[model samples]
Target: MKNLIRTFALVTALLLPVAAAHATVLTETGLAESKVAASETYRLNVPTEKAVATTQVRLVIPAGVAVTRFQVMPGFTRTVETNADGLVTEVTWRGRIAPMEYARFFFQARNPEQAGTLSWKVYQTYADGSVVAWDDTDPDNTPASKTTVK
Candidate 1:
């Protein structure tokens, strides 16, 4: 009985990380219009799970889209960097989000003229200096949170 119990505990420990790897990104408001050339505003909420304090968050905007405006929630500092074509390439937020806490970010942008799906890639840094990336470039790798523009 003791050996069986030990084996069960080992299996549970191994599975914990896999279960915790899934992260969630949610929109505050309901779904937005998925039409091309449509103007949409998104309020994104990102929650931290295993990290004690989330120190930084980075988001990459999809090509062909224009980020007209963006704002970080109060208590955090934000910086926006644009590409040579004047489109927002990346948005970085520096703040503290305690474990189980969430950070809010808002942005308004126009969808690309073409109809398709846009993947927003995100990377997060913890107080311990570890990093978690939400890169969906390769489907086999971590899947990125997506927005569809039909």
Candidate 2:
């Protein structure tokens, strides 16, 4: 009994930090690995991590990826910024994600022809007027989501 109890404690101590480091408020799915030049649909899962509701979310499209379409999320308004060549550079969703609730936004885009990593920067704003930028390169810092083109 003593040995089992000690092992359990040791395992918990070793795994807690790893779990914490990977805790993300905004997670993305789909398009993890896709063929070059393929049109893929991706989903961004945003959770209200704070006590207040999330009021807005902005996503900065990385170079080489051209976002062509977006899915309408209920209660949210979608907006975009275009470049000179008529390409989308940024996408923003305005709505209220109540405390302890989550929302998912979907979009379709064409992957670049070249094989590389596309890092997506996202900013989450709370109703209290605070913003969380998911642009870090480190995992523990709420880094932006990345997709690899094969």
Candidate 3:
């Protein structure tokens, strides 16, 4: 009985962090300033340097929400990627986002669990084949924003 109890406790402790990662948002500076509006339409915008024709963008969505709609600004192409389950893994919002330029996407997020915090990570692929990963931490050493969503 003692061993079983100890094993259960150890397992629970190990799983707690993994569970929290699902809810915790890691916002890294992708290329510019970004923000999330709590309105019915969850809006996101990332302003960063332009990507070469061969560049790829890796935009990750927060675990708690679903991306109902996604669009990219004109002058560039875009693609949406999904997991085998058909769930969106990442939306490759492409196009040469002009240096000091901004790109945006919209989504309809449902918070049935009434979760508090919403977050995700984003990575950028440059035209030269370089990669920039932003999981909500400042990659370029920029400050990240967090909020208490009601």
Compared with the true structure, what per-residue lDDT tens digits does model 3 show for residues 1-150? Answer: 999999999999998644432112222222222233423454455555444432455567555555565444566566877776677767776666555555555555443245465545656666677765555465333222233445
Candidates' C-alpha lDDT: 0.76, 0.80, 0.51
Clashes of each: 1, 0, 7
Pairs with backbone N, CA or C atoms under 3 Å apart (clashes), candidate 1: 34-150
Number of the top-ranking candidate, with lDDT as the measure: 2
Give the per-residue lDDT of model 1 (tens digit) for 1-150: 999999999999998766545333433464633679977776655678664888898888888778898754788899889877777899889989899777778888888999888877888888999877877655455567777788
Give per-residue lDDT, candidate 2, residue 102: 78
- Candidate 2, residue 147: how far the Cα is off, in Å: 0.7
Reference-based lDDT, residue 98, model 3: 52
- Per-residue alpha-carbon lDDT of candidate 2 for residues 30-98, written as tens digits (9 for 90 to 100): 336777898888777777878999999998888988888888788999989999999999989999999
Prediction 1 TM-score vs. true = 0.77
> For candidate 2, which ten residues in a row score worst on lDDT?
22-31
List the candidates' TM-scores in order.
0.77, 0.81, 0.55
